[model samples]
Target: MQIYEGKTAFRGIAEGKIKVYRKDQQQIKREHAENTQEELLRFERAKGEALRQLTGLYEKALKEVGEANAAIFEVHQMMLEDPDYVESITNMIRTQKVNAAYAVASTGDNFSQMFSMMEDDYMRERAADIRDISERLVGILAGRTGSQMELTEPVILVADDLAPSETVQLDKDKVLAFVTVHGSSNSHTAILARTMNIPALFRVNIPLDDTVDGKEGIVDGYHGRIYLEPEPRVREELEARQAEERRKQELLWQLKGKENVTLDGRRIEIYANIGSFGDVAAVLQNDAGGIGLFRSEFLYLESEDYPSEEEQFQVYKKVAESMAGRKVIIRTLDIGADKQVGYFQMEPEENPALGYRAIRICLDRPEIFKTQLRAIYRASAYGTVSIMYPMIISVEEVDRIAEIVGEVQEELKQQQIPFGDVEQGIMIETPAAALISDLLAKKVDFFSIGTNDLVQYTLASDRQNPKLEQICDPHHPAILRLIRLIADNAHREGIWVGICGELGADLTLTETFLNMGIDELSVSPGLVLSVRKKVRETKLGEKYN
Candidate 1:
């Protein structure tokens, strides 16, 4: 028996036979081509075929997973068709006078190395994507069919690492769990596993050999361990854990569509915080009241260049129409800080978390801000769409945001573009905003306290730093006091205040939020019903009443 420990991507328990996934490493051999032109033609043909394969994969992933996961293939397709990639491969073929396969391999190696050496973690991960696409093209040129796994029964899949394309192509039913030797919790594979609700353990030192294949294995996602040929006692415990998880899921399902009201009859809105339109399905499945925080930064982050107003409009419109009149509070571009965009040309910051980001970036780059504002305004015509600005510290910032929104509305009116009256709000994240809540509350329709930043800034501790976690308490007296102040001030001004941060989902604080008269709590979709259940069980205006 062998035991391995790793990090959990999702919490679950499963026992199955091990299925070692060996990626097809297509060998590129040097071959002398009589004509360079012929080699270029072959490269073009292979590129076209690779694109067709990617498109097929995209459609399959779209059907199986959601659009967000399927977008991986679309990115792969873009990489294959990128002018820089094409020029590099062609240049090598023309300059070296070698076959298409060798040229592709050489160019891919150089590009992948360049990406691997980058300081940014995001750029470093792109190395894997480059290799995946390059191998696909090389396989096509070599007349080698791509590898496919045909599993006879359910198994725990073991791999060194899984590319996004390979991960999406997996049969969800056949793959009971995932154990990988090489992968980050933030990787695409991890994201897919979470989306599929599968047990996954990454960075485990699991041997990928024929001797280990088909071995009975138990994956404890909660503990991030893989047990090979576990004893009866261990197996029984795992079975019980699995049963408990199943029961909890069933209970959450029953809570769906139930009113989020306290025992004392105080109603609180339980909405979902979504990164993109693709998350709408999960929101509906979980029966959220509405989308409270539609993170608009994803639109900017996912794009190769500045997203045009029309491009942004199409996505915002789709999300609004799909919500079908459910209130959607779309937060304006909150880029920088932790989330950075490549094309934005932002300078290196000594302190990015406190530097020019969110509202600061939007205010400075009004063109980009207005483009998104225009899209939001246009989408409002389809359904309920309200805009929220993040990282506001002063009333002047809110006034500036209002001014830009007004300008967008006027431009739409002049263009004869159909748009609905949209509500404007701001995120009270900084201590300054909380201290001046009364003055700021009158400037916006509502206030959504981003407690993630609020706690970090209030306590003078970096929330991302694990060592400082003890100090970064969301339930701290100061944090709770600030939330109460914001709620009180917003209520006095006839506006509602919500929490759209991680703190809102903390079950322990749900009753406290209710007692403090918080109007809404926006959390991840999976937590909506659970939080709703908490709301129903709590007595209003009580501490353990």
Candidate 2:
């Protein structure tokens, strides 16, 4: 028996035969074609076929996953049709006097390498997308089908890594779990696996030899362990753990529709944070009270250029309408730092975290900011929609945002476009914002403390630095006191305060937050019921009052 340890992306248990996925990079010969015209024609035909396949994949994904995820296929289709990408392949073929496949392979290598070397995480993932699309075109030109894994039976899939396209195209029923030798928790594969509720382990050091193929394996996603040829006793224990998890999930479903109130009769709202429209389904499935944080940056990150007002409006409207009458607090474009956009034309900085980002970028580039404000206001007419600005460190920033919003409203009115009265708010992330919470609270409808940045800035510890992990404690006395101070200041001004960061999802802090009079706790959809359950079981002590 062989045992391997790794990091878990999702918690579940599954035992099945292991199937090692091997995507062999095809080598294209540098053969000169008789006619350059013929090579260009072949490339066009292959490109058209790739587009057709991508469109079909888009529809399939839309049905299987939600729109936000299915949007990847649309992105893939756009990439395949990108004029620059097409020009690169064609120019290579004509200039180099090589076959169409050779041109595609060479261009793919260059583009993929460039993307992989980018500083941003989102842009780095695009490297995989470029490779996926290039492989499709190359396959078509070479008279062979693209890389598709066919499963004859259910098995645990093990791979070095999986591209977003490849991960989405898997036969879900036949793939019980995913084990990748190299991948990050933020990778597309991890995101899709969590969305699909599939067990996954990444960063595992496993033998890559084909000799391990078809071997019986047990995956314990909860503990991040893989057991190969498990002993009878270990197998039984795993079965029991799986059964227990199933029971717990069933029990959680029973908590749905129940108010998130403590035994002491104090009610707190449990909401979900969503990145895109696709995440709305999970929010509803988990019975969250409302969306506390609707990250508007995904639209910006996914687009090749600035997303149009109409495009942003339609998406915002869909999210609002889908939530019924529940409130949706959409945070305006929090880009830069770890999340960077190519067209934003931002300069490289030694410390991007503290540099031009979020509201700073929006305020400097009012044209871009105003377009988004118009979209939010227009969507508000469909249902309740509120706007929140990120990285606000002063009352003046809030004042500036309010001014732009007023401009957008006036323009919409003159155009005879209808909109609703949307509430405005700011994130309390920096120490400066929290310190002057009383003054800032009076300027906005509510306060949502973004602890992810709050903790990092407070302790002067980089959140991404593993060595400083201990100093980045969310439950530290200083952090808790800041939360208390913000809550108190906001309450004094008749404004509610909520935590919408990783700390909000921490079960250990649920009661403490309730005692602190936190109006709401916003976490991922998967943690809604669990947090609600914790709220329902707790009784506020006299010390809290």
TM-score of each: 0.87, 0.90
- Backbone atom clashes (below 3 Å) for every candidate: 0, 0
Q: Candidate 1 — which residues are off by over 4 angstroms?
A: 30-36, 81-88, 94-99, 300-311, 336-357, 413-418, 430-438, 452-494, 540-545
Please, what are the lDDT tens digits per residue for candidate 2 over residues 179-226?
999876777678788889899999899987766788999999989999
Task: Supply candidate 2's per-residue lDDT for 432.
Answer: 94
TM-score for candidate 1, residues paired by index = 0.87
Error of 2 at 279 (Å): 2.7
Off by over 4 Å in 2: 74-95, 114-123, 342-351, 411-418, 459-472, 476-478, 542-545
- Candidate 1 has an lDDT of 0.87
Residue range with the least summed lDDT across 10 consecutive positions in model 1: 536-545
